[model samples]
Structures are given as structure tokens and as C-alpha cells.
Target: MGANFISLSLTFAYLAQSFLFDTQVYPDVVQYQLAIEGQNHTIHLEKNRDLIGKDFTETHYTKDGKRVTTSTHE
Candidate 1:
């Protein structure tokens, strides 16, 4: 049982590390747009990153569904 536990723990740790590496090394490009009501009301967004690839963009819509806001991380 102890040997099995150690093997399972090692496998889990390796998998987690691999997942983190992939996400950090290969950042995903996300392009999203949304619109509601009116003829020309829309929100268009494209995420941009710096040299280190740490910047991220997030968009949020209000509960009333009348406004949209965007935020960035560094």
C-alpha cells in the first residue's frame, strides 16, 4: 500500500507540472465579441501579450445587461 501510494503521488505531481508548463509555455489566444439590443451596440476584444506572455484580458458584463467593461493583468 505504501509503495502504491508513493507511485500514485509521483504520477499526480508529474501530471500537474506538465499541465502548468504547457499552459505557461503555450499561452492561448482568445478572441471574443458580444452584442445585445440596438442595431450597432457591440463589444469587440482581442487579447494582447507582452514579451514574457503574462498579460491577460478579461471582460465582464453587468447584471442589467446594459454595460460592458474590460480589465487587463500584468
Candidate 2:
């Protein structure tokens, strides 16, 4: 019983570590859409090319070629 418990604990720890630290799960661009007040809003997270590493650009836009807001983060 002790051996089985140790084995299970090791397996759980391995899985948790992989899930918490894995970088490959992230992508270059992610997008989401929402409807509020009968208008469509699109939010985007894109990898920034101007920076050296891992920076992101966030942009929000409407359906009719109108930009609502934009921001950048590292």
C-alpha cells in the first residue's frame, strides 16, 4: 500500500509540474469575440515583433473597421 501511494504521488507531482511550467501550451495569437449592446467586440492577443522576447500586443476592435483600444505588455 505504501509503494502504491508513493507511485501515485510521484505521478501527480510530475503532471502538475508539467502543467504549471509548460510553455508550448501558449500560442502566438489568441482571439475572442463578445456581443455587448448589439455591437460586436473582438479582442486579440498577438506576439509583438518590435520587442526582443515574449512580449504581447492587445487590441480591441469593432466589426466596422473601428478600433476601440490597444495596449502592449511583456
Candidate 3:
């Protein structure tokens, strides 16, 4: 059964690699999409770049979320 063992090990290794690179899929965006065990999620977040660090503005009565109207160095 050595062939079966090798196949199973390879499958497990692939899964582990996928998990480690979960954050790699999201770049230059404030949110991420992830799926696990048939459950999915869209996580909201704010990231700092070279130009500005953790800077954002939110206005009042803005029903829309993540609607960036103003930015730094404008």
C-alpha cells in the first residue's frame, strides 16, 4: 500500500500549503474572502501602505460601507 500512502500524504501537503497562503489571495484591498469546511466569509479590514499608515475617513449617514471618498496626499 505504499502508493496509497504517498497519495494521501501528497493530498495533506497540498491542503496545508493552501491554508498557509490564505492571506496571499487578498492584496491592495481592504477585505478578504475565505472558505473553510463549506463555510465562507468576507472579512473587512484596513491595511497600511508605504504612503500612509492606517488612515481612513468615514462620513455620517453613509449607508454604504468602505466607500472611500477622500484620501491622503490629495
Question: All models: lDDT?
Answer: 0.41, 0.53, 0.47
TM accuracy, model 1: 0.21
lDDT of 3 by residue, 1-74 (tens): 43321111111222546668767653444445556445666666554556444565544445665544664435
Model 2 per-residue lDDT tens digits across residues 1-74:
33321111111222556667877565556556656555666666676756643455567778998877544442
| Residue pairs with backbone atoms closer than 3 Å in model 2 (clashes) | none
Q: Write down the lDDT that model 2 would get.
A: 0.53
Question: Could you give candidate 1's per-residue lDDT for residues 1-74 as a string of tens digits?
Answer: 33322111111223555677675553233323333332333333333545333355566767878666454553
Q: For candidate 1, list the clashing residue pairs, or say none.
A: none
Model 2 regions lying over 4 Å from their true place: 1-23, 49-74
**Which scores higher on lDDT, 1 or 3?**
3
lDDT score of residue 20 within candidate 3: 85
Weakest lDDT window of 10 consecutive positions for candidate 1: 4-13
